[model samples]
Target chain A: MDTLRKTRWLLVMLTLAACKKPTENIKIVIDTDVIKYTALINVTDGQNGSPAPAATTIAITGTAANDIFELSGKKDIKLSSGIVTIGLRPTVAPTTNQPITVTAEINAPGYNRETRQVTFRAETKQQVINIQLTKTGSTAPPVVTPPPPVFNNVSLTFTGRCPNRTDLEIRPSVYVYFKKSDSNAAFQYLGYMDKGNISTNLLEQGGTYDFQIVYGAETYKVSQKIDQTSYNLTLDMPAACNF
Target chain B: MYFRRSIVLLLAILLRCYQVNAQNNNQPPSLLGQKSILLNVGTQGVGAEFAYGVLPNLALRGGLNFIPFKAHNVFKISGFNSTSNLSADFYNVHALADYVPVKTASWFRLVGGFAYFFKAKGDIRVIPSDDYKYGDLVLTEDQIGYVDLNVNWKGLAPYLGVAFANTFPRNKFNVSFDLGTYYLNKPKADITGTGLLEGNSSQTPQFQSNIKDYRWLPIVQINFSYKL
Candidate 1:
């Protein structure tokens, strides 16, 4: 009995001595947005709301043209799937009297040139620009795609996942698309996702949809059923897309 | 100061009791032999000691003690969404003297000791949970990082307490309780953070200030002894 007691005491002491510090493997993280003013420019065929023709280029012209830049900080902006995000440099701020104004000149090989004015207000940090281009000398009136079927309003919250860094997440600001998971149809534009959140009446309740987003040549996809009115979805992006 | 005054009063009473008992009867068998060993467990940790009777009323002891413990989710900081983990380790080696004055009641004695704690440390880390978000982007674990807070008080400490029961058992077994405190040396603290959290190191001074006055460690322990 005495020896047993002694052994127990020794075991207790050894157990305590082997304890490791809690914070030894812990870490904290923070992310920041340096681009304060952003706008998404989506160009489409006027007839069917389909993607614009290839080799589309966008030009900025105005007093504040020098301050315009792609959301990725590039001065040369191009369209991807009829979409591009442009923003004012972090250093520029628009005021009531000095509201920044710029003109977007979009040109494609088979479509008539189109120009639209883009204005930046101080309070609104994000905006969307939808440009519908008319085909040169086409006689048929523009065709409008039928609206998506709706059951109940649904809100989707998107989170961007980084492939290389498991601990980092991104709230993406990009256009979103959806299609029936079992169908052969191409993905159709749903709406814009602002900072990873969007609410729409397009998702029918009890229907399964495959969601997709194209950024920098990569199209990421996630599938979910619209059983509930809301969903938190994840879109995995490559390491190069981390910003 | 209160502990010192109490110790003086206790010694006086025990000495008076011993003197009276000695005048009425010859000295009984010595309370302990020339050598004895003890195994103890207490609030401070677990330890073993070897004791030698230096006089009929006093004995000298030497021993070592150690404690290791880890606590999870013990800390939370405001304005930061994080999970905190805490751990502590204390180890010491010491020499002490036990003075028994009451001839008839040898179980009660006064103890004073000095210990050198070669390993006394506490650590806390704050890790951001997976739910953490900045704007609309969820951060990866590496980009988010973590912060660590470390404090150490590894040096000499003085201990004082009362030991109840004999230092050496009458037969092969003995049990005793010790109530005392160790005044540890001043503590030095530091903070470090990784990745985006590296900025947390600036709070080290504030943490140090909050813990500057925490230098006293109380001990309540039980010892089992055997005569050698």
Candidate 2:
């Protein structure tokens, strides 16, 4: 009887040693986009092609105003650094025959209030509307400057990181803007980034630049030196982490 | 169906053994220089082995085994309706030593061995079952894709078990049972996704951690041996 007990104990120990804890690390990651049809409104000073003044505000009006919302799903639309992304409500969408149209009114101190018609069509999911505002008393023609010099192609891959989720990474698809790091110039329109990758010939070598993107009513910025032909940049986008 | 057929064959062999009378005398049979060939089926699948008695109470055996299986919709994720495909393949070659310590009970033997698994892999792919929609827009299959989880445990593994019945047949043939477990190497796991689900590759580390300890492969086999 004693020998049998000892044998049973040994077997139990061996079994326990061979055993492992159950799976606790497999997590289902579900990512879904709510607002599909979007329009990016960029407000600029008509005289010198700079961003609108700090106090500029945007208001949506017209028949489809009720269906319009900020990319963050808020009814109130405000500009951050003279840019705001607006989208139709998740439950509403435009049809092929009956497209949705709304008027975006921009108000800034000392500059003439400007309004632009924004339209959402069934075939287009994303569109950018540029609105230039002139001073109320100025009748002079708007200044037109030559475009920036084009240089060797520079490739950038942006990775969005979540502050709270270490395991989650985001590949954002949106428009990009950039300016020299040391300059106070308003960000110029770069090309659209498709799934976090973009190649452009606008950046000069040995120059440092700040890249920016606006998504979900929030702005994310990253800076990099342009010594190399390719770079991997990381941006903290807490707004895009709503999974 | 194959597993069912193997069980039926094992039962028929057990019945045949019952009909044959047991040896009346209890003197342990001389096993030196004796050899046999065995065919087996169990949790490890079908296999063939050769056994040689090298000592009075000990024998050495060598063999190979393989199993390939595939199924559909066996794995699922909570709150997500998806169709899944699961496949598993395992193949190994092994050598073992069987030692009988009790002269009075030669029918029971302690078995220890090591096996080198040339191929041990499992894969599961899950795809969204329904037509996915983004807001009010319907998406095509290419716009919304699938996720695959893979794991491999291919390496040398040590085995421990016990065998019941004589190593060699009293007559020309005999049937025996073996129960054992193989301590396989730590598994490596990964995840890959295509299209919109491509970001799921970030979850590979967590998936590897979850399956790191799943290294024990259990075996329960019935062996039919014919003496040479």
Best by DockQ: 2
Runs in model 2 deviating more than 4 A are: A1-37, A61-69, A72-76, A88-100, A120-125, A140-145, B1-26, B30-120, B123-147, B152-165, B168-189, B194-196, B202-228
Residues B1-228 of candidate 2 have per-residue lDDT tens digits of 554685698677655553442352257776688899999876676799999999999999999998776667767765566898877777999998989888767777899999999998888898989876543345566666789999898999999999878888887888988889888889888988886677678788878886777777877788999999
List lDDT for all candidates, in order: 0.72, 0.79
Instruction: In angstroms, give how far residue B181 of model 1 lies from its true place.
Output: 14
Q: What share of the true interface contacts does each candidate keep?
A: 0.04, 0.15
N/CA/C clash count, model 2: 0
TM-score of each: 0.50, 0.64
Model 1 agreement with the true structure over A109-191: per-residue lDDT tens digits: 88889999999999888787888888889766765666677666899988766776654445566668888898765457788
How would you encode candidate 2's per-residue C-alpha lDDT over A186-226 as one tens digit per residue? Answer: 78888777668899999999999999988765789999999
Backbone clashes in model 2, listed as residue pairs: none
Q: True-contact fraction for model 2?
A: 0.15
How far out, in Å, is residue A56 in model 2? 2.8
